[model samples]
Target: MKNFAYTRAGSLSAAAEAASAEGADIIAGGTTMVDLMKIGVRNPDALVDISGLSELEGHEIGADRIRLGALARMSTVADDPDVIAAFPALSESLWKAASPQLRNAATLGGNILQRTRCPYFRDTAYSQCNKRNPGSGCAALDGGETTLHAIFGGSEACVAMYPGDLAATLVAFDATVATRGPGGTRTIPFAELHVLPGDTPEIETVLEPGEIVTAIELPVVPAMRASHYLKARDRESYAFAAASAAVGLEMDGDTVRDVRIGLGGVAAVPWRATAAEDSLRGSPLTEATAREAGRIAFADAQPLEGSAYKIALGADVVAGALLQAKSRMGGE
Candidate 1:
């Protein structure tokens, strides 16, 4: 890693002020940031450490909403009884993520802000990685390894896949991210936090430079209790997802009252499957209906040569997640 000056911000305002400087990056848990820096994918001139800011720690599970502080450890949130009971999918997403050591250290803000796991983007040896270097061609697209590339939200400039678990559940539950920056504080829908890999693949989130994510707010809903997040990977543990689904279902007798779906590992951003949710609104929550919804979820997929299997695998994951959610509905 490159030599960089570091400062531990004593307050939110101080953090924002320090991070606003040119080439300064924010560091909380340092899980992803350190790795990227070591690989030469990210080389900040300075790091503004905000991990000591107590204002950005802990969580609150209220009757109407759940607020997870940006610095709240992933394990803390995943192991909370209230979070598990109220937002199982959210809890599971964190649980199924990295190992116990990582969960203990990874913070909510850093987890959402984690970059892609694309080999081309990580290895500086590859000259073509639009995400790493704008205007550079994408090596993953030019007969490179594409099994992990995005099938949705990919443009001619980039096809990198998002590799987070919690963000997908947040998107499924319509969570909001609160941020404080040089311009002041604001809240945006979590779905809008991540931008598509369009012409500017290098730019990812909508967060402004020096903006610090303060917290994530999720509305408490009945359907969320019946939610599930299913991740299909090459192995049983510690492997990144090949295809994953986050699903929440509300059932009324044999009919579906409401549903929310989010897909990961197959898109440039945490993907909300609105079309699939719309298709299953009045339908029964059965294997057949779930399968149909899954099919609808991937209808617009534009898979690459090695990633074509993700369509089928992603559909199966969606179907499995929906069924698992249904099973949690107290035999409804």
Candidate 2:
């Protein structure tokens, strides 16, 4: 890793100011940023540490929504009784991520902002990763290992997946992100936080330079209490998902009254499977109907050779998650 000057910001405004400078990057938990720096994917000249900013600490569960402070530790949120009861999918996503040690140290904002685990992008030896170097071309597309590449939201230039668990649940529940920057504070739809890998693959998120995510707001609804997150991975723990689904279902006497589906490990972003939700909104909640909805979710998938299986796997994940959500409707 390149040597960099570090400054612990006293306040959110200070952190934003320091991060706005050229060649500067924000560090909170340092879980993801430090890893990228060591791999030469990130080489900032200055590090603005926001871990001490008090404004970004703690969480509040209110009647209307749950406000999760950006600096809230993953373990802390995962263990919150209110979160586990009302937003079980969020809690499950956090607990299922990384390991116990990482959950103790990693913050919610850093988790959402974490970079992709694409091998081509991480190894600088391969000079064809567009996400690492714009216009360099994507090695993953040119006969490279594409088992973890995206099936949706991939342009010809890039096909890397987002690779996060919590964001999938957040997107399914219509969460919003709050940010403070040099231009002041603003709220953004959680789904809009990560941008598609269009022609410019290096630019990942819509967050501006020096903008610090302050909090994540999730609306409380009846369906969210019955939500579930199912992650299919190479291993049981401390592994990135191969395919996952975050689903929330509101049933009306075995019929779907409302449903929300978010797909992970299969897209460039935490994909909201609106088509799948629409397909099952009024249908009976059954294995056949759920499976059909899952198929509809992946109907427009554009998968590479090694990633074609993700289309089927992701679909099954969605179906399973929906059934699991349905089972939890009133039993929780």
TM-score of each: 0.99, 0.98
Each model's total of backbone clashes: 0, 0
lDDT of each: 0.93, 0.91
How do the residues 1-332 of candidate 2 rate in per-residue lDDT, one tens digit apiece? 87899999998888999999999999999999989998899999999999988879999989998999999999999999988998789899999998999999999999998989999999999999899898999999888999999999999999999999999999999999999999999999999999999998888899999999999998888788888999999999999999998898888886788899988888898899999999998879888998999899999999999999998898899989988888887522
In model 1, where do residues sit more than 4 Å from their true spots? none
- Determine which window of 10 residues in candidate 2 has minimal summed lDDT: 323-332
Write one digit per residue (lDDT tens) for candidate 1, span 212-281.
9999999988889899999999987877889999899888888899999999889999999999999999
Error of 1 at 113 (Å): 0.4
Most accurate candidate by lDDT: 1
